[model samples]
Target: MALPIPTTLDEITADWLTSALRQSEVISEKTTVLARTVEVLGVGEGFAAELARMHLSYKNGSGPATVIAKIPTSVEDNRNGSELLGVYERELRIYERILGEIEVSTPRLYYGDIEVNPDAASQLERIRKMERLPIWLLRLILWFLIRFNKGKTFPSVLIMEDLSPAEAGDQVQGCDLDRAGEALEAVALLHAATWGDRCPQERYWLVSSAVAPRLFHAGALGARRGFLKNFGRLLSDHTRELYESTRTDNIERTIRLHREVPQCMLHGDFRLDNMFFARDGGFRALIDWQLSSFGPAVSDIAYFICGSIDPGVSEAEIDALLARYHRALESAGVSDYPLEDLHAHYTEQLLLLLARMASVDLLDLGDQDGRGADLVSVWIERLDARMARASSGR
Candidate 1:
């Protein structure tokens, strides 16, 4: 039987480590974990999950000396929110079915699992029972339950080969041109490998390729309201006008319009914080696959640039980096996608990004020592500058 999934750091024990390692075939059956020290990692850098470094001593001096263990957030609201979006299942599915098949750089997964909440299962049944009722009634009940947040939680556990000593990039600090180039290269490799593939199309449940209008519309409205309250002073007239134009329907339309372009698997949440850089100034790996999806690959490009590029980066520099990304894609054998098309799509991606600004409000930033808010503040400044330049035809 599979080991019980741990919800908190305290539940990660030596016995559990031994069973999990053996189950994943990472260690021999004879190997036993004698002791382990857990160090919580990325304390406030992540919102959906919690991570820790497990330093282990084996009875036979075999198996990995250290590994990274990931678990669902202990916060009830975040846990339930994650479950509602199926992000836990999506991450596990990507690790199991997609990552190995692609050329992208990501941490090596040792073992991954998500335990369905029995209470959630029961609640699901209750929702199912109402299916026989009128369609309107069902919709009303679901909307009400979702609005108030019902009892839903999916506890997940993922253990992976630790890639420490590699530093995580700072979103608030942004990145230099060299790091930006490396990030684009990594994204190109991913998009090129999955370009126009049927993996996501066939395994629909494994990827969130399609946009959910209801969920997005609701979130966007709230996000927009909160963003205006917190960062309205930072917006220039042009940017504020631009932000005001990204109504819920317009945002959806912008995203949906890109459907005509080639699609690929995207690290839906591509940003500096999600990437690790080697000490020698090389990209190590990308983490946080909860938002993995298939979409116009350039969307990831725009997301990365908007969040990571230094706010003062010149337009020419940004263009050069994008050109480099295009060349990398071509080098990987992607054809028929031209530089002009990439640029055009990138502009649209920026507008969609403006709509996405509100999303910052959804994050739990209470424990982030204001770093999260500061990150968003800087990110908007970058977006505002970029959008202004775009408007002036620069």
Candidate 2:
């Protein structure tokens, strides 16, 4: 039987959230209601039906205030087991520890929750019937149900300071050199601050011992069979050959590189989607530190460059950005690390990207039939072209 389609914010009301919040003890009945709204933001094309931001309003004794709430996407929760909540909780802890210690920007956290709301019973019932729903959709419905299920659960809500997107808005399409530079700068600061000797022992160890192993395991398992099977079904014969030629060898290379390379704290998912810019271009804030781990610095750097930059960005611009990144790292006192080593690490990072694109449903170029195929084809073409040039001693 087909499951019910996931419910939208349009299908839900502020009252639903308010009741959930009150019931979960995130808010009290005595708190004055100011305004309630659910803005569905950043619903990326993936099985992870994670909503990026949720805004809530109520009156304190002095005046009205707003808080941004985050709920885990169902796909992520299911894939990792019930420990997803623990991950978010740990993320908050790490964010708090590094807030003042690091140069990287992050929002001020208020509170977080891991409980279900008593009012979502009806919504949960509808969710149970849905079939063929995307993973993201399933997560969306599950979030509602989790919030509505009757029981006292700890930390069922988190309050955070609201950071609005830049007035100019997201520059996902155009190749803005200045913005690109700013993004790289932000990443550099993050990498520098999180490197060895600079970071706390606990933080560093978490990356090296826990996060890195989990990511490598997940990536390896998913790529070994799951990703190739799906990706092969999605590509044409010629495209498949290009992808296979560009992919399998690179995966082996990356595995070897992972064994040989020194590890550092890496933002596992460093992409444009996770970045927020200030209106005046004064600063850029990196969010979603849940996937952070100890790995090669090149991994984060490559992800940002490949995933953030527009398709039209020239090779010259890419080189310039690469130079800037190295300079930033050196200035941050990463003197012992050679530029050549960084470059090699970057190649390994690119291989990781190939593995990721093959293994996951995260990229959002467009619909699966044409746009997605075109985007994947373009990626494969770029990979093959770059590999050919390198082999030819370019």
Candidate 3:
């Protein structure tokens, strides 16, 4: 029988590692985790989950000396938010189902499992049936439902290769041009590989459209409100107007238009923070699949360029990066997508990304001292600069 998925670091015992690694064939049956030490990692980096680096000792045989373990966040609000969006399930499904078939550089998965709350599923179903309810009442009910579902155990786990010594990109610091080019090329590889016929359709849940629009509609109200509350001071007159225009109706229209484009796998959260750079100054791995979904390929590129690049980065440099990404995609055999079309798609995607930025408030950011707030502020500032430049015809 399978061992229960570990929901907390303490629950991730040596026995659990032995069993999980064995089941995943990361270790021979003769090799058992004799002892292990777990060091909590990603203190302020990961919002939807908690990560730990586990150093291990084996008996009878050899195995990976170190690995990373990911479990659902203990932060009550964050965990509940993750459940509401099916974040944990989506990530587990990606690692278990999609990663193997793709060429994107991701951590080697050792084992992964998720036990979604049946009660949560039923509750969502009930809410879906109540679409006739007044919008205000439905939003209020969902707000309370999110609070009520707090601290519920929806255990999910992933044990995977540890890309140690590789530095995680800092969102607040932003990415330099060379590194940005590398990251863009990497994402282009993902988009090109998953383009058109290669897109996954068997798992409808992996598509962004699979989730009911009402959930996003409800969430956008709070997201916009929260974003305004936190970063309104940083907004310029032009930027503030743009932010305000991301009303639910506008956001829905943006989403509808994006859906009209040819779809590909998007590393939905493709920002510097979710990437790791090898010590040799090369791209190592992309982490955080919690937001993986199928969408307009440029959506990922637009999100990264608008949110992750240094705000001071020149328009010419940004264009160079985009052209680099386009060249990489062409090299990878995605011939039909023209550079001009990519730029147009990129512009539309940036607006959608602006609306999506508000969703950052959905996670629990209070515990990060001030880094969480600072990160969001920096992202908005960078994006605002880009939009301002675009509006000025520069």
Give lDDT tens digits, candidate 2, residues 1-394.
1112223334224555455545545567766445656665554322223443554556652222455555544443232322322344445556666655777777666544343333333432332345345444554544444334443322323445567754322324423767767777777777777666664554321434232322333333344354566455544454345445553465355556656665566666665556677877755576666666665677777766665565556666766787778888889777767877777676655555655565443223345564344445544444433333233232
Task: Name the Cα RMSD for model 3.
Answer: 2.6
Model 1 lowest lDDT segment of ten: 119-128
For model 2, the stretches where C-alpha displacement exceeds 4 angstroms are 1-33, 45-49, 52-65, 75-87, 115-157, 165-175, 199-205, 209-262, 361-394
Q: Which candidate has the highest lDDT of all?
A: 3
Which lDDT value does model 2 have at 247? 34
In model 3, the Cα lDDT at residue 67 comes to 96
- What TM-score, over all chains together, does every model reach? 0.89, 0.66, 0.91
lDDT of 1 by residue, 1-394 (tens): 9688887878889999899899988989999999999988876677788889999999975998899999988765566567766778778888888888889888889988887554543443443355456544544554454456766465789999888789989998888998999999988888899888643663433443444434454465655666788788888899888777776355355546456688888888899999999998899999888988878887899888988887788889989999999999999989979998888888877877787677676666655356766777888888887896657654
lDDT of 3: 0.79
Cα-based lDDT at residue 245, candidate 1:
73
Write down the TM-score for model 2: 0.66
What C-alpha lDDT values do all the predictions have? 0.77, 0.52, 0.79
lDDT string for model 3 (234-298, tens) is 77888777666666455465557556677788888888888999988999999998888877888
- For all candidates, what are the clash counts? 0, 19, 0
Candidate 1 similarity to native, TM-score: 0.89
* Candidate 3 Cα outliers beyond 4 Å, as residue runs: 117-138, 150-152, 202-204, 209-214
Q: In model 3, which range of ten residues has the least summed lDDT? A: 202-211
**In model 3, how large is the Cα lDDT of residue 283?**
94
Residue 210 alpha-carbon offset, candidate 3, angstroms: 7.8
